[model samples]
Target: MFIPYCISLYIIKGNKSIYDPAFRLFALNMGFADLEFMALVGIFPAVSYFLPFPVSFNVCKVFGAFSADAWFTCIMLSQMMSLNRFVGIFWPGNAKAIYTKRNTTITLAFCWIQGLIWTSFYLKPNVGLYFDSKNRGLIYDFRLNGTETVFSLNMIFNYVHASSLCLTYGLIYLKIRQDITEPYRLTIFHHFIPVHDKKDVSYEDNILEYKEIMAAPDLNTGWRRKHMLDPKLANDRKKENKVLIQACVICLLHVAAVATWAVSQKIATAKYVLFIPSIVGLFSSGSTGYLYILVNSTVRQKFASMVSKCWCHKANQLSNYEARKKDSGIQSISPKKDNEYSELMEMDDYENVTKN
Candidate 1:
């Protein structure tokens, strides 16, 4: 999921994705943070686990702290993205004025810096390490009892982060309700929000990039500025609708994924199943990259195109080597031509490496 999605991300950006530039770049940041975190915790540990000797406890603590930092980064970026969407939709005008390219870049950098700073406090003493005799390497307990206070503080921080996310998205939902002409009834067998009705209407909407909401009446103060965007496109009509669906999907998955952890924490002697949530959470983290594909059809198609081209090219290359050789040479013979062909082949090889 990480490799393909990341490669496809580059390809899509190279070709100019159908999504907004801000959103595209934000998604890339999310992928990078997630990939780093997954590698630190998942692949790095797996490699150490197979080594013939245990690594130093200090080294273990360093990696664990880095992992925490990366994970924290991922959470913060998600919140940033959610906020971007919220402001874009709820206050589009101000969004354009505030979320400029420079600001976004700074925000991305800040997320990483702040995340590392947050984790640094607990890196020194808040860990325990043990040699896994069977695995022939060290395993770490990142949350030492001595630092339970710090751990509790971190948990509170996470809760605050989660709360901010919910609040922003909730406001977006409420704004959507305010904009819609008809008061549609919401039904939930799972027992959620209440229902309402007004006038029946189609799903079509003139969704502004959501960035051009009325500029607040503080022109003299030079408050948030507004950028004029192109006229609404065909997809603009259902912009909020799409966001609504995406938000609900993320919220639902998050609730389900975290439930196991909540339950596991309750039992003093919970069986091996207590570990199941950790496993589930790991797999889910690895898979978060793929969620972009599921939610964005444009991304999905781009990925499919990339995968198909690689498969077809490989199959064709394998089936008729002579033909491929001839085909490769047919495009060039002179030195200049040869150089051009070489460059193209180099690019193709580079792309293939990234895809794999």
Candidate 2:
């Protein structure tokens, strides 16, 4: 929730032109999904842990419903983000036309509706879905106990969540590999160019020149040159690639964790391997916001400015209270003139004058 809230603020305050509508929608979805997941799954599990109050079977069912909805929405939005990146990279020209704000918004609305539809399956009085035996017991056994099929709706939701995450990470891996390899090919081609007098030519200088030539292209040619040739572009690409790789790693971890838990359950084990992975997955979901902070110079500046403002505000409040105390003779003024205090007072005065 903090991640997407910060990201959304950055988008709204910063460059509107560069902000993709799909990315904004993804962020919004992520915020809500994280809130729902934390509230339904994380908080409830913690509640069941500490509270002596008998856990209500119906409450457990509600938690399942919320978890299913939240997990589905998260996966759906994540897949959309992956597709958005794919469109931006592979079809930059058509991306604007294809992923307009209205269209993306509609798509996200559909995703939520779809999640709600799936979630409705557990809304009944006798959904009778107890995730684990330790937290929930035979108290949950109800009318739907024997009637419920082995392949329940909740099971389908879990499968979808795992599969979507796996698919998203697989696509991201392929995309990064393609981007990385393309640059390598350009670098290799530059190496093969023959130099007569390698001394005057300065093989290093030749490579640099080749990189520059490939960095940016003329408007006449539609092809975008690989960044590997140009050191600057290559560095930028490396940074972006790192973000994508981090996202992929997080997705892979989620998949692995969920798969292990599913396997354990199928083997009639009591182990809950999903717990660690789910927590880690939630933490990893912040990668998109972190990526924004990493890539966008504007966002970094805004974040710095916000932090500075908060500190300054607190300092001003503290100074005002101190001044009031001194005037009232409630607090003794220090005998020694501290340089730092004097500097801070001067700075505060300057800021006050500017504000006025």
> Best lDDT goes to which candidate?
2
* lDDT (C-alpha) at residue 342 in model 2: 35
TM-score, one value per model: 0.65, 0.60
Evaluate candidate 2 by giving its C-alpha RMSD to the native, one decimal: 11.8
Cand. 1 Cα-lDDT: 0.58
Which lDDT tens digits does candidate 2 get at residues 27-126? 5576678667666665667678678875676677777776767766777776777677667767778989999878988989988987887677657555
Superposed model 2: Cα runs more than 4 Å off: 1-18, 130-133, 136-243, 267-281, 284-301, 304-356
In candidate 2, residue 257 scores what lDDT?
47
lDDT of 1 by residue, 176-263 (tens): 7664423221111111111124344322321221112223323332222111111132135354466556655555444444555445
Best by TM-score: 1
Q: Flag regions of model 1 displaced more than 4 Å.
A: 126-146, 182-233, 252-274, 317-356
**What lDDT is reached at residue 49 by model 2?**
65
With a 3 Å backbone cut-off (N, CA, C), the pairs that clash in candidate 2 are 211-229
RMSD per model, one decimal = 14.3, 11.8
